[model samples]
Target: MTLASGLTLTVVLALVSVVALVMRPRGTSTVDFYLAGQRVGVATNAWAICGDYFSAASFLGVAAAVYATGLDGAWYAVGFAAGFVPVLLFVAAPLRRFGEFSIPDFLGRRLGSERVRLVAVGVVQLVILSYLVPQTVGSGITWELLVGQGVAGLSPYATGIVVSTAVVAALVSFGGMRGTTWTQAVQFLLLLGALLWLAATVIGEGFHYGDAVEQISTAPLGNPAPDGGLATEPNALHPGEPAVFGEPGARYDVLGQIALMVTLAMGTAGLPHVMNRYFTSPTGSAARTTTVWVLCLAGVFYAVAVMLGTAAREIVPGAVADNPWLDELTVDGVLTVPEHALPVLGRIYGGDAGLGVVAAGALIAVLSTIAGLLLAAAASWGHDVYERHLNPRATQRQAVRAGRITTLVTAGTAAGIGLVLRPEAFAASTPSIVATMVTWAFAVAGSALTPVFLLSIWWRRTTAAGAVAGMTTGVVVVIAMLTAGTVADGSPWPDLLLAPTLLAAPLTTVVTVVVSRSTAPPPDVERSWLIMHGTAADRHTQALARLVLAESRRRRREVRRARR
Candidate 1:
């Protein structure tokens, strides 16, 4: 099985490399390297964004959360899928219309302040690093299970981290956004295909979804104990009550649930990699259309993930007697590490081949996301920092070279962080550490970046000073709350503190508005607003497209007459 799995993984990586090489940017132009020449169509960008958005957190963590905590875990998927809605409504079109390389680029230019851009770069890097480390962690976890061997004296886990980061960094550095975009789009299809295959196999095995949920609900949820035994979890919502598989209290309480959802939902608008995909659109309308497709596609992907999580809970326990490997992975039918639920299910129904498909899917999830994050980091450092400030007169080739260097540095940094924080140290304390860490990134983005991002677009009075202050305040408040929550783990209000977007976002908004009112707006505020909210650019793009279509039709008619 390990050999077969290794072969499958090698094939997937080879195919990804081929795509990156084939689609590599033709020139060193910043536009080509960073935004794919602004030529990515609606469908391709939609698929790529889905690939970027659905990380290991979405692939493994969501399922693991569901397998571990039941209904409460389902919210992770719900929140993740819901996050796109705000993007569609308030962000997608305007962001593209603004026409900048990244979030920092847009904020800096819109507010007419270099200080705003630099401050935004700082916040965006924090968000990217926050998001990047977990992906490396997830890769390590998957590799540890799938291969179960080490390279060069490194543990299997460390090897996974180092290998994944290196491969993805090289792909991003060489292929740039053009190559990365196509590879990501293809990878997303593969990820979805793997999930669909698993779902079909489970259903074919006479598994009934509703009945399974009801059956599992009959018993209290049990997790792996510290002593390598089974222990029932207490309900956080209802103290003294045993957590149930079909209920909400297995992980978060009422307030915690709301906070988690809000953090995730609003955070999508602020994520640098996800939001940067919007800039690759040819027009604002195309960006909006791409987002619609993303919503539909993401909806299906997450729904399937939720179903599989439920399926794993129902089926794995009963199959333990038949599969010897299950003895070590599970405790009395429950997975010791909930993230293993999908891979274990794959092996049970499909044999080693099935496990290969699922394991490859997990690695692809991590790799695709890592590629996007590295690109985002590169754009920030190369375009935002080096090109704009360090050497304003840098040539196009120099700028692109800087981006490649940034990608390598960022990947190395993330890998180092992943190594320092081993999974064994925190696995017992969290339901799905991948998902939880991702939520923290969401909390920071929603609290700090989202409020200011929306304000800069919607509010004409938004000043650079106001935006800076709001972002700074948001970062400080979220960090303080998260730290306090960690320190006071057993307290009732820890849920709110841990997922602090609910508290941090509104306060940030108020601060932004108040500060903006007190200060004079940017001198060209009206012009920026028109560019952001007006349809002039969309209209021009439509006109040009019509002219091109007309010319093509004329040429085709001429060829037909000549043939006759």
Candidate 2:
């Protein structure tokens, strides 16, 4: 790495460490450790949520997708941004109103069954592991490009995975959710700022976005072939036609587009890490407001990503003549690894310093996301599994300790998995493997957890047996389809298999309803609904906060009078 790049990365990591240490939980209270004492404000939580939500997938993968597939790649950004809508409309308020430490805790309590909790815990862990691996993979990819060297006798990729996981594991274990919250919020701002800076720099260099898109659309879409050469991808929608940069058929057809969007949208509601953030909100109303801010922020971030991707498509080829280093990274003016789009653009526009900024943003994205996933895993294994089932009378300190241990184990496991799975092995199959892998996680959550989660909230008749049955069916069907898709490559049903949420989610819902009809509902369904849908808890929390603020103000006034 260049001196500027190394210094930039070091500074960013230092800032993150300082923030985590400064915001570490103050007590042994489980609530404080896991949910930040339920005191995080809406705006801060929203930024942290954005940090958690926009993983390496958003920072690198989305731009890479747009760089490779053009219009089809832009859909990844759209779907990602749209995913929050369901959370805002159906999930945020109710989920916070019925506050709990994790998804499994909420479901287990709502359904009044240990069996349900255990099953949900299993599904949640699967989701977290799936999500965690991608963040590690992204870190590895960034390290491969940024540092270009490994430490401790490891390859650059492996080194990246190990270092990132270790640093983030330590942060989460020490800081818990409170420390993580502040760090994530800061990380997200830095990420946004990096993108904005790159955008302005690019646009200032006479890059007309509209003209660029129109100009780039004139040629057939080309990517690196398996044989280390450029090849034009055939249009899936228009059988004999060549795919173009501004068109849709470069990647997905109509069904594929819809399926991908639906999967991502529904998956947001079921994501354990993201949903857990809602529990940190002071009130249900604040959670709802947080979602609003998240939507607005995410929309801006993705829009810029899409624009930058387009700019890269138009700008990179012309600049390749000047930068000799670009030869190996590109084939016939097209990037071999789509994820390198933003970093490459950074180098082209601002040299090593610019590359450092974007690369640091990418690493921060991975770090922030991994922290959230680790905390979510800790909540599941430590709180839901160890404390609740293994030792019901466990002290708060013990539970918190268990959570820290879980964080380390989970991070280690994910790093191992990331090492085993090489991005180059699957690069030929998708525009951005990091983005695609994350979408699979989304598919699992959407299919297995979201349908059941939504039903348990909206349908009183959703019995524990029904939920178990639905979750099992969703997991089975999604896995089966994904496995079949891998084995049956080039099949006409690739879209359906790749994004099985459309099929799996509906099927899971049907199974849930069918099983629920035959089984008895929870006895406390009315009470659960009152807690979930009712606004009384929100009002109560708001009143308490106002009272506390008023009392503080009165005390300050008295102190001032005494001084006079």
Candidate 3:
């Protein structure tokens, strides 16, 4: 049925996010619009970060990957969650300490380099766009399956992308950070709830996880071995399953797996939208705390997704085709669209309303992520470009106006890209398409920008030139890979997990250090350190207030001593 029951749940989620936007206090200041006046608390900000980070990939892709492969797909979740560990240890607190609206702001002011800011801005925009389009496409694919209406000269896929993008843009434009944060926190909880609920119901249905694994192990995963060898379907439940493991593809090696993990983990620090949330925290310490919380939240959610993927394989064999939307999207009985697995299972277990809820949650996931990315784009353009470059004399109101304009423009640009390369079905399934784009972004950010940011904050020797060189090398390598047909379908090595990042990131760091050693460092590197690492004024004020109270107690003791 159109607007499947599970989709109804999704509608409620979207409505709730919208209500949050409408009910939030109108923002009047730049700080409020950009960083929610920097007043977000630790727990709330952490949850919001989870909402932003989860995205379509975590919610849909993780489960789909597991369902497609066996245990190997679980690596996606592990890699994604592990990225936060580095963020907490090296990046989060220092990032907030700088008190910038976006990553470019921090780098620009820290190095007093306008060129650095511009380059950073360009990279940030590229990464954000790359990340944003797939999400829009994912939303469209989901809507097509759930709603089935080709409205306004658009297919269901296109309609989903437009509607979802518009909703997020509206929320970000009107509600700003305050409303967006609250909605995202709530949405994350709902997403977790949906995942946990599905897991519980699946387990309760008496599906044995171990038994399922053994059952799967019996088959030739995705394909069989030919002539009783690995060439033909080896076993029905084992590696013969081409739909899951690329039955017709090559197996990845250990080095490749390590590279994939490194790419994802290091790349966390470079994601523009996720980094933007740091500005919302009250202090660096709070941002660190938020990362810790996010780690826990991500751990639980990912584990559940892995379990659900296994269950989907065992419980509903050929269930992909039974669902109305799945029939259109799947290739034969197998899912061409791995992203649809979890949502399809939701319908199978919960009926129409269950499907609606899961679908809506998926939509909400995209909406929240898009809103965050759009805001990051706005902050980068408005603060870094219009204010810093074009109109240094502009007032706060003017800056806010610039920000709004940029938000609209960035959102439109992202939507345009999503439309131009939009896939007919399972766009994400293509080896060099959605997944490749995402990996390229990760490679760029991790290889170039992340190392510089970490060294800038931690190592005293990192020069401004070093930072620029590193970022440049990283971006150039990743871009070249993307354009060079490195990841084209049926390519031998492109599908390897670390084929891009593992090779490119080290080159970026080497270039950075080499260039840095040859050039004189910034004159006020010490002063920049103070600015980036120093405690916030408000935090110091509170400390002084506490000290004064302690002094008063000491004075009373002295007076008592004198009198006695």
Candidate 4:
């Protein structure tokens, strides 16, 4: 069958799922609607977390990065996966213990400051919107490549934007967090399975990973020759040879690379959607366990993604006219679609059926991620703003309605922005889609939120005033830097703007510290410190696990005796 036939079936199946999820009734309580009644199993919640975390970045961008930049692009996966380690070790358990529906809610309660809450909500919303728009862009690009359809009067890109936003908004509005979590978990597994299968098939076809990497490393990174602009040949390698962009020992600037890595690694704790997932776990232990699972799952997925990326770079020749859609996008007969490299590999290895599965998985990646972000955005706007500030007397149903409305508004706004800006498609890949957008989100979150959160949890003297001051300074700096670097084309900033998180975050720490020293610390800072570090809760969690295990053993023994 044709690729179009397979793609059509995939789209049909995904859309039909909306009916079953939306028809269900939402419960009255905030917990029921937002945290899935706090009964989500560890394994399920882990999958959902992966779903929320993967985004379009993981499905398309990672492979695309690999195809385009070789090992350097693999750092995207490393930074992303490493982000969770901090979340698990430092953020997840305490965050779950806080038992809030969203990060803004948790901060509002922890510091008892409305002003802080408001500021956080605004920052959270910005982060969500920034992240959301790119995912929509990614969805559009994927759909255009896969199905070749553009709904009435809309470009294929616009069609993707409209369809993805509508579907995700509908799912979120109807299901709330409860329905969304289940779908997200299932979707994550499907996404990973697709990645795994694709990787295995590539390897099974006698693809040599090491040889492929050597070839890619030997080739020049970025556009060849005139388009790529020349520099001095490296002491270690030729000017055209692929090398890190910054820092010593590495091909690139090491400091710059580490900065990007640290920003992502630290920023995961502050991301509203990711932070919100901790609330869905029933207990702190469950939250910690979820992170552990995430570590393992992410490790496997990223490793495979790098391999697939290397294989794509090696197998997919630079020639464009040989493949469909290559000529339209490729400059000077070379396929420029770095993102398409992976999809092409899918078609080559899996044929039409494989391409369909991979495409559908990519859609699921965007849908699942957008669902989580929209829910988080809704929680910030609906629960934090509408319910808490506007209509304090809102009933559970009314609050949920507010959440739905917020979801629609947020999704619509993101879709509209994507329709307008339409991320630049490079070569064969959606290079500017999910990953770059997500990087912006990380930069903002790292710069604005991570410094304050780390200080708040670790430093006893961290005053509410300090937290507020620090976050504000960070957010403003990050915005200014990014705006100047990206929007103001004539700005003097170095190409180092490619990684903004490095500069934006440390300045935030300095601002926070300088401000905190001048202000009186909050009186309850000691209590907050204890909550963050004291071990009583950890002991209780361990005891509870033992008790549950003992009970299960007793029940098994009784059943055995009865049978005998």
lDDT score, candidate 4, position 72: 56
What's the lDDT for candidate 1? 0.93
Residue-by-residue lDDT tens digits, candidate 3, 1-564: 444653574566566567666645465677888898999999899889988988877777677667665665676778889989999888888788878888888887777788889988988888888788878877876787667687779977788888888877877777778888888888888788888888887888787788888776666454211222223212223344343332322233455566667888888898988988998899888999889999998999888888887787676555654666556545544455556777777878788776776777787678778888888888898888998889999888888888878878887887887876654333333321344346556766787678777777786677777788888888888777655534465655453433367777788778877887898777877766765666677557656877999999999999999999
lDDT of each: 0.93, 0.93, 0.74, 0.75
443-494: candidate 2 lDDT, tens digit per residue? 9999999999999989999999999999999999999988887779677779
lDDT of 2: 0.93
The sequence of per-residue lDDT tens digits that candidate 1 reaches over residues 1-564 is 377898999999999999999999998899999999999999999999999999999999999999888999999999999999999999999899889999999999999999999999999999999999999999998998888888999999999999999999999999999999999999999999999999999999898889999999998988888788788989988999999989899989899999989999989899999999999999999999999999999889998898999999999889999998999888888888888989999999988889999989999999999999999999999999999999999999999999999999999999999998876566677788888899889999999999999999999999998999999999999999988887775766877887899999999999999999999999988667777886786656766877999999999999999999
Worst-scoring 10-residue span by lDDT in model 3: 224-233
Off by over 4 Å in 4: 1-26, 222-251, 318-334, 425-433, 488-495, 523-532, 536-564
211 in model 4: Cα distance from truth in Å?
0.8
TM-score, cand. 1: 0.94
Task: Predict model 4's lDDT versus the native.
Answer: 0.75
| Better candidate by lDDT, 1 or 4 | 1
Name the better of 1 and 3 by TM-score: 1
Stretches of candidate 1 exceeding 4 Å from the true structure: 537-564
The count of backbone overlaps in candidate 4 is: 21
Counting clashing residue pairs in each candidate, in order, gives 0, 0, 47, 21
C-alpha RMSD of each candidate structure in angstroms: 7.6, 7.4, 7.2, 8.7
TM-score of structure candidate 2: 0.95
What residue runs in model 2 are displaced by over 4 Å at the alpha carbon? Answer: 537-564
